[model samples]
Target: MPTLVVAVFLAFFAAEYAVETGLLLLNLRRARRSGDAVPAPLQGVVTPGSAARSRDYTLANGRLALVSGAWSAALTLAVLLSGLLPWLHQALAARGLAGAHRFVAFLVLVSAPFWVAGLPFALYRTFVLEARFGFNRTTPALWLKDRAKGLLLSAALGLPLLYAVYGFMALTGRAWWLWLAGFLTGVQILMVWLFPTLIAPLFNRFQPLPEGPLKERLEALARAARFRSRGLFVMDASRRSGHGNAYFTGFFRPRIVLFDTLVAQMTVPEAAAVLAHEIGHYQKRHVHRRLALGVAGQVVTLWALSLLVPWPPLYRAFGFAAPSYEAALALFSLGGGAFTFFLAPVASWLSRRHEYQADRYAVALVPEPGALASALVKLNRENLANLDPHPWYSAWHYSHPTLVERLRAIGEAGRPA
Candidate 1:
């Protein structure tokens, strides 16, 4: 049984790697085939130079992804099959640590290798690849500071949550999974509520949008759509990268945050159109719908874990000497992606659908129907986004429709009935 489990794990792992590599290669080939010419829909929207730059950027990032993915898979497979986990568990046991302490320590130690291994790739991407495209603004000192803060924050927040999970598993008997799932769901909600106010400030400064025409325009647009929010704010996103985005955070008292880069690049109408699109997400109840689906996913995951946590063969297949919740959790965290990779297209499809609905809603609310389309084009050009991607690749990977598709939809939405 243990051998069979290992075989199945290896098969899934290999299949997922092959599929991901294939999709990336296909996308890169499609980009290459597009040459330097701008697509017909975007002929005048963006220059040929911008189109060529976007293609090069796509190929650069895709190559990096291919290398990074292979490295990660190799590292994970080595750790899983090398008997390292069992040895580490035994070493910790010999030190007289048990229960939550042992589990937390084990998890931290196991994760350290992956973290260290990934640092070079992160650095190269930020300093080399992104910088080459004129997007990276993160200095080395800032990068190091951010990494340190992230690690500390993870320890501060993750440790308590992990300990609580262990406590429930130890104390709640067979119903532990149910209790843990409910507790985690509550935590998720609390994090959502607190993130905008408490967590986000740790990394970037956010300030209310100045009392100006843009603010008034956005406020009016929100009012017209009957969408209520805490307020409009701008984030200092250019501190790290030249990329621009806008999002709303928090379940209650949600605040609309626009990247300063975005604000600087867009006109009043375009910015208002962007805000309207964000408001459309709320008006259409996309946020609540996604949250509900996420909670359901959590419940299902916890239920599945309950069934697997006590299965001796699972632990044995992963080099553990005995069945243990901590071991099972670790193994699942490492290997679950092999099975979940198949679900990416489903998630991507739902997200794209939401984006289209939001776009339509924005067109209905904004004074200038073309503002959103123009904003989208400018965003793609400025961000150097892949203007054309393989259909299969986009369907499987993109959370939003490609630029051409979006422009076509917006144009159709604007036409007479």
Candidate 2:
């Protein structure tokens, strides 16, 4: 490898890890010092004691992320430096697995170690940190079962898709990325269409929103928005964690799913407000906008990868042998993080903007914004969110606005009843 190539890669590599570590620690300190008192905006809305617990929860998660991030980064750095990819490529080549089959085998072989390696961290997060905070609901046996299902799910869907991509790459010559991009775009659409009915039920049970005031209110809210759906359902999400959430799923029609824990704690109006906010995402086209942006990104990245895969120097810079699709995917997967690390703020900004837009739509739909504001506070307290994070760190990490910001935005919204 040329000294310059190695130097550039290492520089970006080290910088990415350093930036992540800094953000984690900075947010941790900010949360710790934010104190136990609720910010004035939430003074009447949120209890003071909840703020302290939220800080503790943030701290716990920050600590976990710091450790896990460092461990994973170190593991990745070691693997790249240790020349593992080339060895794997040679072993598979010796077996004479050609075209799509080779990529499929490579995907499975490389993914297994990563999967097993992450098991300990997953276990620790669920059994230790989350349990300490009273959020964990998953058992050890259930965890293993989930992992097994995940592996099966990945193999069932991922292999065939990858097979087609590699096959098209070899057959169609230079335009393989365009073909792969279209193929991937189709897969993304398929998943969205099927996830609500076919895939989601594989892990959690989903039942029709039980007949009650909450259901009646949610149905009314849906009707007001003129959104059609498979009807509302309650997911047994609390079976795994105490954290509560609600979302819209499905490609053609909307499927509103509420976590059981969310329903249990929130008042009827507050629950209705939450669902309104979710429905707003659909009504406002935020979901489709995101999907379009993501598909575009895939197309661009695949096009770039098609250009890079034939370059031997790029592989040698990372201590790999001559270029192959499997090697290109592995290298790109490992190295893409470093190159895109700086784009974190931009992505977060877009997401937060979408969130605020959705929030405005909710305010317009609901009778009042107070219920959504109150619901946000309850969610912040229950989920142990960092009420105040350093602006820089939040810009890089937070998808939604801080509670204070959202409350202010909600107050400012003058949308008609």
Candidate 3:
């Protein structure tokens, strides 16, 4: 039964990837066919040469399908091929090596092919595609530095947790869920607590916003929204990419964080308008609601995992013995990965709704609809974002409303009701 379930789960993910790739290919072909760059709310002000506009449009939508498809194929191959080893171990009764550690080592080995297969494509898009569109500001040295730091950070944060979870499952057996839930909750809290103060600084320098009119404007918006902020922080985002973004981080006391890349471009009014949108998230209590939802989901997941953890069929189907903790752990990891395949679209839908709500809140508070619209356009254009995308593809995949949809909302806000 467990083996059948695993097979079904894997098949579903494989199908989803195939569909996703088809959609991306269709979209890329369409974008290339359309010569004019779609009008962005940001580019409403600046005129670009026709050739430059065409280049940007093509790069924006091209290569997405190729990258996504290759990644999907690599991951699928890894999961399927790695299962063969445990099958061998189970047949031989060299069972000591078949447990969780060995299973994880097998997974790690499987991942190398996918990692190697995707790296060059990623590099080409970031360097050539983005540079051709005038968005790549990162030098090759800086790019490699960032990748090295990312690897270190992932190891530092992820390795110990993986070991702890595997160890807990192996040792506790039936009661691992309780310990797993507790550990995950603690880790989530710790990441939130330390993210603003510790982890962030390792990647980018953050300084308090200089005392100025912009600071006063931001503080005013925060007060109006009735949320106390730690202070405004500026992160050096330009070192990596020209993409602009802002978000509020921390739970006990959140700080308003803006990338220097964003600040460098927007006027004080525009920046304040963007800040107002972020403040809107807090004003509407979106953060607390999201955290609560996440906690609830974690509990539900733990319960589901508990049901399968004790079942012998699950281990046997995955080609491992019921008594073997390592085999159980590996199967559980693969199951978790499979479940995310279906859940991703649902999560993205909820997130997009939250963004729309926040945008409405921003319009109400700032009353600078034009500025917000312009800011979004410029950010998207500079980042080489696709203005027109396939609706179903965007619905399932995108976290935010497309630029055109956002602009329309802003335009609606400005109309006399």
Candidate 4:
């Protein structure tokens, strides 16, 4: 039976677009509802009765929405058109004009331009708009250097994987999902292993924590949470942005990285509160849960792609010349992207749940709910994060609970255990 692949692709896109736009509108309304109830510290950052300042924030959000929407649309179109290159390769093979591997190489070459198109917008958003907001400390030179490094690194690691995927689809099309899943899982494991030592240093500088009250408090919090980290390292995040963040990255080679921006302004107790949240993620097993969800999602997607690729109308629906291994890849990408668009809300909901769970774990372990609340307020103020995002927006895009929500949760947890 000929599958209406193009129709599936369009349906997927429409579903995603509707859900995303709806979520954004919901968040915008929530932001409006929060009104003057924004955390006290955040009020000082917004100049009261300053029309220009208000306009700037609104404009930035609008720009973010526009860029995000356009990006999704453009990439969808690229994936649909990509089927053309694969079809050409198939025709060449029929004429004995190219070997199978050459066709694979040609398909890979054709996809590079589409892959690179997103880079400029990403750079501009981080270096230009973020800089204008007094959030970026990264020099243009440093930004470009980092970008180049990322591209080279991705190509070095990803190219061979792509070739392997192509070979798997061509040779083991029936059980290709299992093979592809194993390969993908292996790559993920390798990346996790390399991230701390090889990947992270290419962007940020990490140093052992300085001797200070903050360090002592953090150690105490870590002990309370029953966690052990290799070292407390401070990252030079302030050089690139004013955003304050702390994360626990690396699995086997675990490290705790505090952004310099975080440490510079936060009090010792506040810093400890932040560290508690990171440790809470580990203590609650949120990382493992997230990984499980990711792997499951990948397996489902691979299985779906395997089914869709063998159907002939999928190629015709996308205006691809005929069914071929490479054509199947392009179709899968297009259709899969569309499908994931609607799936965003489901994933976002799960993520927000995990974040709330981690917050609960933090409050339970540290019993410093007040400090955690204060830290949340400070982080929102420093980062210029929207204190009053529409509830719908927060539900759809926010992985973490809103600052107010988090503080409220902390307050609720203040009861004697």
Judged by lDDT, which candidate is best?
A: 1
Evaluate residue 46 in candidate 4 and report its C-alpha lDDT on the 0 to 100 scale: 44
Cα RMSD (Å) per model?
1.0, 1.7, 3.6, 3.5
lDDT of 2 by residue, 207-232 (tens): 99999898888889888989788889
What are the TM-scores, per candidate, against the unseen true structure? 0.98, 0.96, 0.85, 0.87
Model 1 — which ten-residue stretch has the worst lDDT?
317-326
Task: For model 4, state the Cα shift of residue 42 in Å.
Answer: 8.5
Clashes of each: 0, 0, 3, 14
Q: What TM-score would you give candidate 1 relative to the actual structure?
A: 0.98
The stretch of ten residues in a row with the least summed lDDT in candidate 3 is 42-51
Q: Which candidate would rank higher by lDDT, 1 or 4?
A: 1
Per-model CA lDDT versus the true structure = 0.91, 0.85, 0.72, 0.72
Candidate 4's error at 52, in angstroms? 9.5
- Whole-model lDDT, candidate 4? 0.72
Residue by residue across 161-256, what tens digits does model 3's lDDT show? Answer: 767777777677677887888889889989988988988887789999999988888888778878788889999888877778888997746888
Specify the poorest-scoring 10-residue window by lDDT in model 4: 46-55
